[model samples]
Target: MLNFVDWLASTSGSIALRESLYMYPWIESAHVLFIAIFFGTLLFVDLRLTGYGFKNLSISQMNSKILPLTIIGFILMITTGLLLFYALPIRNYHNLFFRIKLFLMLLAGLNAWHFHRTMNRQGKAWDKNSFIPFWMKASATISLVLWGLVIISGRMIAYNWFDCDKQPQSELVNFLISCTVDPEIYEYLNGI
Candidate 1:
């Protein structure tokens, strides 16, 4: 998979986008904008679930009104994110924060899946009530935390603090991040 993605990363389109002076910034800006949009819309639903804000708006009404924006935001966010990754695959592939972000996204997705399933099954019963169940609120809280962590992790990807080429990493870190390199190259680069 890495080999295939490496090949794709080396393609002309990816290289062009990555090497372009202005295009990368524009794509990154779009990615950030969509992330804000998606998370902003999600905030309404989460707050509604927690019964802390949007109390006047019923769950069904909130879902009906805000779901479209949320979906659009999510779709665009994913599209921009993929384009960003396509531009630079190998660096992001070995990034610790990228791995962390992906894991958090998976957990967040599962939480969302369970939340949606339960909400769909029992939403009519309590959709109008200002008082929500503890489990639903808990789930929403978890979603907020996980997504926040995901964003932080994603942002951390730009930092090279733990880059694979940086030595003095533990054996486990090397294994986890595939930091192995030719000994001569390592020593020459590090002047060790």
Candidate 2:
């Protein structure tokens, strides 16, 4: 699996992205911008759901108004994020912060899924009520925390503090990330 990832990382598309003077930075900027839009909209909706703010609009109405923008932002973010990942698949796949970000993202997705499945099924029963159910509030809180952590982890990926290449080879970081470092890639990174 690691070998295949390394191979993909070395592909033409990846190489092109790495070699391009502006493509990588532009894509990264897009990723960050989209993330801001996505998370910002999400925060508003979640805050309304938790009865913290946006009390003027009902929960259903708030969701309806903001969900489209959130989806759009999410789509754009994912697209740019994938391109960025392709540019250095092996480095990202082995990074602890990247792994944590992925995990948090998965949790956030599941939380959203569960919220939609359960709370949304109740129609407008609690939509107009400022006092949302405990479960809904908990879900909203969890989403906020998970998304915040995801952003932090994503930012940490650019730092070499805990990067795989900077760690001791014998450390268990590889096993934790579920990927081994390719020798050539290791040597290349070390030589830099």
Candidate 3:
């Protein structure tokens, strides 16, 4: 299974689509720009949920307006992110920070999805309540924190704090490589 995942990661269109010179960087830049927009819009929405600001607009109405921008940003982000990852799947596959970023991204998405579902189920109690629910606040806080971590983790990947070839073995690295490839990449490196 590990071998399969690694092969898939290497074979994915993200890596293959950007063999052209300079294109990878261009796509990566676009990915970063879109991520900025996504996070900015998310910050606005989350802050509103937590009663930080945006007083005049109803949450539903605000959601309607900004949701389109968010979706657009997501499209740009996912497309370019995949491309960038594909551009160097092996490098990313073995990076500890990259694995952490991916985990946070999944959690962030689930948190957002759960928040949307709960809001839909509520009967205007949120609008009437003077204080936001503690759970909602927690979710919003987690969203922000996770996203910040995602960005930080991504940036950290470029630093080569410990190249896969130089790092010691651990369950975390073993698990991450299994997500996208064989353990041999790390095993071969850590063995030395």
Candidate 4:
């Protein structure tokens, strides 16, 4: 896995991104913009599921109105995120925060899948009820927490404190970063 990631990091696409003055920033900006849109729409629906707002609208109605926009924003966010990751595959693969963010994203996806499969199985039956199912409220709350963690972890990846390049010369740090310690790269990093 490390070898494959290292090779990907050295590929022409990654090299071009590193060399291009604007490509990386543009992709990053797009990723952030789409994230806002995606999360915004998702939050609205999740809030409704929690019976906190949008009481006038049926759950099915709100979901029908907002889910499409959320899906579109998600598609755009994922596309741009992949491009950003390809730009610095190794650095991202080694970043702890990135790992955490990915894990949380997976959990969030699973939570949504479960909620849809179960709570939404009955269709519009509960859509007009004043009180949402406890399970649905729990799912919404969990989704919010998971996404919040993902966002925080994603933002922390930009800080140099735990970045591979700034890691201390310790075995734990080396192992965490999956540092191959290739002589060429090590020497290059060391200003050889």
Candidate 5:
């Protein structure tokens, strides 16, 4: 995996994206912009599901009005996010915060899947009503928490407090990051 990441980083496209004077910044900016668009629209729907906002709006109505924007934002965010990752595959692969972000993003995706499935199964009966299932509310709340942590960890990826070269990690932390995965990379990191 580390070798693959190194190969990716060495590719002409990745090198161009990473070394470009303006392209990297522009892609990163677009990523942040789309993340806001996606998370912002999703936030309203989540707040509604929690019965804390949009009391007059039905879940059906809120989803109808907000989900499109969320989907668009998500698509663009993902696109730019891939570009960002492609530009710095090795660095991101090694970053602890990046690892956390991926884990949390997966959890967030699962929560969303569960939420939508339940909403579809039981939603029509209560679509216009103020009675949301307790689980739905909990799921929405969990979504907000998970996404919040994802964003925070993603932002923290820029910090190097836990970089492999820092060498301050305990054995458990090293194990968690799978630091021993590639002997060559591990030796390189420790040698630095």
Candidate 6:
């Protein structure tokens, strides 16, 4: 599997694609943008579900509109996310926060899928009511929290685990570690 991933990474360095200069940054940028879109739409929809905004609009009506947008954003996020991971699978494999982010992402997906199934099984009953169901609210809350964790963990992976200076002088880096590095991206994170 490592060989396969290494080959996949190496092949992208061909004339058709400069992996580091072009593909890597592009994929990373797309991932961030898509995540923003996904989370922005999600915050709105989930807030609505929790009866914080758009109280006048029925939950069903809000879902009808926002759900499609959410799904679209999610598709973009997933696509770009995969490409970004493909670009740096080895780095991520050794990153602790990256592992945590993946776990959180899985939890978020499960939360979303379970909510969708339960809500569908309940039909229009929950939506028709003035007050949202307890479980639906919980699902929305968990979705937001888990997604937030995923984002934070992703950022932390670069800082906490993948510091090039801390990386051992070996052919492969197979674990996460906090270490000193030059060209610090987070100038304010001196103590970190």
Best by lDDT: 5
**CA-only RMSD, every prediction:** 3.0, 4.8, 4.2, 4.9, 3.7, 7.0
Supply the global lDDT for candidate 4: 0.83
Write candidate 6's Cα lDDT for 1-192 as tens digits.
667756665665332333457776777788788888889889988998898887777777888888888789889988877666666666555566777788899999999999989877874787656676798899999999999999899778767434444444222332333223443434434434
Better of 2 and 4 by lDDT: 2
Pairs clashing within candidate 5:
none
Q: Which is superior by TM-score, 2 or 3?
A: 2
Across 1-192, the per-residue lDDT of candidate 3 in tens digits comes to 446546856664645564667787788788889999988998888787777778687777667778789889988898888767766776677777888899999999999899878888872777666456789889988998999899899888876554556545564655665433455756776676
Which candidate, 4 or 6, would have the higher TM-score against the true structure?
4
The residue ranges of model 5 lying beyond 4 angstroms of the native Cα positions read 181-192
Candidate ranking under TM-score, highest first, comes to: 1, 5, 2, 4, 3, 6
Per-residue lDDT over 86-120 for candidate 5, one digit per residue giving the tens place of the 0 to 100 score: 99998889888999999999999999998899889
Model 4 segments beyond 4 Å from truth?
A: 128-130, 169-174, 180-192
C-alpha lDDT score of every prediction, in listed order: 0.86, 0.85, 0.76, 0.83, 0.87, 0.73
- RMSD from true fold, candidate 4: 4.9
lDDT ranking, best first: 5, 1, 2, 4, 3, 6
Q: Count of backbone clashes for each model?
A: 0, 0, 2, 0, 0, 0
lDDT of model number 5:
0.87
* True-vs-predicted CA distance for residue 81, candidate 1, Å: 0.6
Per-residue alpha-carbon lDDT of model 4 for 55-143, expressed as tens digits? 78888888899999999999999999888889988889988788879989999999989988976666566864556678778999999
Which window of 10 residues has the lowest lDDT sum in candidate 5? 178-187
TM-score of 6: 0.77
